[model samples]
Target: MKNTLPIALSNRHVHLSEEHIKILFGEGHELNKTKDLSQPGQYACEEKIDVVGPKNTLKGVRVLGPARKNTQIEVSLADGFTLGVVPPVRDSGDLAGSPGAKLVGPKGEVQITEGIIAAARHIHMHTADAEDFGVNDKDRVKVRVGGERGLIFENVLVRVHPEYALEMHVDVDEGNAAGVKNGDMVELIK
Candidate 1:
């Protein structure tokens, strides 16, 4: 496992706050976990919402489980272009100054002030994994993917935590461009 990490392709998804979840799915309604994600304690919910943008609407956008402090919508650059919102490539939860969109649920609709973003590519590493890779939290590094469309990814942020598994996450666009799929191995450029 020398400088190797598995890749996970992230599609467009939404994370709702408790208040927003209540407003969207109705009072006392909790998210139904359909499947567990790579991250610990996070899951994909059975519920989905419609994201209405200035230009178009994305229907059936899956909502991630485990309510967050703020509601954030993560989209790919292509999705952003389709939605007519230029969401910045930000880390998860770094939604300040990002674009906002209208989220329509079965119960009601929520107009977020600012939460949409095109998430930056990053790696989640456990403390032991970071120690093995010689990386610290928030450290940016380059990653090499080998394939017919092989390319190097730069400025990939490292997030270190005890619960985090060692994996690299990229948007759908990035994965497609690199000709990589989920579970593909990538090398950390030291």
Candidate 2:
């Protein structure tokens, strides 16, 4: 039997810190949960902000909640082109030398030193799921998708944690290239 996981297409979004949230939204303002994400405790916020790059400004970018330790901006490769930024492809939270941009909210705006990135494709597996697949944390694997645009994605990272649900996340560029959508099952190529 082949091990498979559901695919989730991630679009351009921003994760804000508590301080940044207060600065962007308002003092003591809280994010309103619009929808729950596949990952536990993650949700879409009702608020949206604008991302100003050197070349152009991306308006009304959705914000994800709850606030994180540091604000991170995840954008698709196409978004990078639109913003005139060459965001490095990095794993989420691994934004050391990536690009930065100005984030504008209703109340205020923030200039991030370095946080923008084109997130790498990865699978989020629970410990039990990892055991079932015989994979470990931070393992690199390949996934094969079936369809007219079927292709094998290489160097896909595997993230294992107790709280993580079994799902594969891909940026819009990858998803469009593979012709895959949310809820589509992709086989793990060991």
- Candidate topping lDDT: 1
Please report the TM-score between candidate 1 and the true structure.
Answer: 0.99
> What's the TM for model 2?
0.98
Q: How far does residue 140 in candidate 1 sit from its true spot (Å)?
A: 0.4
Instruction: Report residue 170 deviation for candidate 2 (angstroms).
Output: 0.3
Residues 6-74 of candidate 2 have per-residue lDDT tens digits of: 999999999999999999999999999999999999999999999999999999999999999989999
Would you list the C-alpha lDDT of every candidate in the order shown?
Answer: 0.95, 0.94
lDDT of 1 by residue, 91-131 (tens): 99999999899999999998998999999999999999999
Model 2 residue 138 CA deviation in Å: 0.5
The weakest ten consecutive residues by lDDT in model 1 span 1-10
Error of 2 at 98 (Å): 0.9
Clashes of 1: 0
Off by over 4 Å in 1: none
RMSD of each: 0.8, 0.8
